[model samples]
Target chain A: MDKRLALILSEVFRLKEKEINIALTKADVGSWDSLKQMDLVLTLEREYNILLTIPDILRMVSVAGIVDVLREKGVALED
Target chain B: MVALVTGGGKGLGLVIAEHLLSNGATVVVVDRDRDALDALPTSVFGKCLDVTQPEEARTVVASVVKEHGRIDVLVNNAGVIYNEPLVNIMKPEGIMHDYGRFREAVTVNLDSVFIMTCAVVEQMVLLRTKGVIVNISSISACGNEGQTAYAAAKAGVNAMTVTWSKELGRCGIRCNAVAPGFIGTESTHQALSVDSIKHILQNTPLGRLGKAQEVAQAVATVIENEFINGVILDVNGGLVI
Candidate 1:
């Protein structure tokens, strides 16, 4: 699950998988603007087969935040 | 490319669909008229549905995506040409335009475009398809006198086209409108009086009605050109100029 999440982030942000980490935040990524944020939200929703709320989307500014939001949405992130 | 054209069963929409098919596109046509859908060519896919309803729009879009895998282009062409002056002094009573009729026109013309676009755009984004949207606006969008509802609806369509072009460009989606002038379609003839058409011809530099094929070609051009976004291409033969 971790690897998949990293892959999605890398693909959406155009970053290397090695560059993605739990510490990575929107500020740390150069391409994590509003547009890419929408892409990320869509990608995660499609990948997890879950609909995200506005608060869930806003809370997902960092990798750890994304994981927390997923968990809150009943997405089991533990490998 | 897989193209979905609403109101493609007859008239200008049918011509547009055929033009796309000739250009090697897989065209799916949806219209509210069942008889018209039944008359479409065997090569084109036809579905009967009212584009104004959100659920029906979503369902048709889903079915098309399920069959063709993705929708590359969506042409919003389903609309009614409503002509009524805001005030008709000739009438004995109710000189003002009927609010119900105005609402009906706006619903069919503008709301249908909104509903269909949302449905197709969702599929395009989810499938990651770089898609194009071509809205069939009218020359009346600039505010013709006897067409309050039609003009307002088409102007709204133009605004939405530009707005979506900016919003969806990052997602590899392009939106544009083709505002055709007095096209020599049956509907155009039915909509205008003989004197009105003559006046239009006198004002237009081309001095003739536009062909349906010409509008279709404009649609094709916008779809094929990768950089033409948020443009309202006028196919009016310099009528408004």
Candidate 2:
């Protein structure tokens, strides 16, 4: 889950692998905005091949929240 | 003088058509919306056109030249937009649920611009007329959320603006673009929330939503100013940094 979340964050925000710390938020990242937020949601859904509702997108505000939503959707982490 | 304005039936296009008519230029409003065309003033020439179809574009241009004798100004103002996030767009859901809207937006906004511009340029060259083309770009060209396809397309428009300027400059023709910010159109006003409006105002030094007339005025200025070529005139009230 951690690795997949990192990959999604890095690609959507165009951040380096090291820049995608778990503590990342809209304030910590300059590129983070409503538009990028939407893009991030889309990228996650595409990457995981899962459907995210508008409610899910609106509720996801942090890295942990994103992981929790993915877990709720039953996306298993690779061991 | 014959002037062709793609998507001239409403909003910015309508304003441009009215402005050109006031300037004594015969205006041709080309759009796919027949009902919208019917609503336009009778003095303006309204043609039902699907500009993405290159052959139709050629036919429309030829018909205009045959009727009007010469071409002078071509304004590519017809465009569409999709506000959904890209992920929801790529899902394998039904057409309406997925990125189908994005495909249409790209076709109408981006592809049509290329087809129409090329068609007009060919006519201008064959007629040996020194012409002007005003491409209606957007603030999104600099990048915006929920507008990946649109931003890419407008960016392409800006690039083509510069490239066409160079290609057509030696032919005594000019090509430029008008990148508009938020305007006070009914649709825009409806789509944006009060906070979104406030945010836009705060970012814009002018502290106001731009008017369609203001954008039309800029387009007119670009058309008249032969010295301004391959330049994108930003009418976004300084919204873009």
lDDT of each: 0.92, 0.84
* True contact recovery of candidate 1: 0.00
Model 2 C-alpha lDDT per residue in residues B1-241, reported as the tens digit of each score: 7899999988889999999899889999999999999999999999999988999999999899889988899999998755655544223343132456667878888899899988988989998999999999989898876677788789989999999999999999999999999998876766565656777888999999999999999999999887999999999888863
Supply candidate 1's per-residue lDDT for A58.
72
What are the TM-scores, per candidate, against the unseen true structure? 0.75, 0.75
Which sections of candidate 1 miss by over 4 Å?
A1-79
Residue B229 CA displacement from its true place in model 1, Å: 0.3
lDDT by residue (tens digit), candidate 1, A1-79: 4888889899998789999888989878765655567688789889999998766777888999999998888887754
lDDT of 1 by residue, B1-241 (tens): 9999999999999999999999999999999999999999999999988998999889989999999999999999999999887865334356578999999999999999999999999999999999999999999999987789999999999999999999999999999999999999999999876656877999999999999999999999999999999999999999983
Candidate 2 achieves a global lDDT of 0.84
Candidate 1 lDDT at B64 equals 95
Report lDDT (Cα) of residue B126, candidate 1: 96
Model 2: CAPRI class: incorrect
For model 2, what is the error of residue B85's alpha carbon versus the real structure, in angstroms, after optimal superposition?
2.1
Summing lDDT over every window of 10 consecutive residues in candidate 1 chain A, give the lowest-scoring window.
A29-38
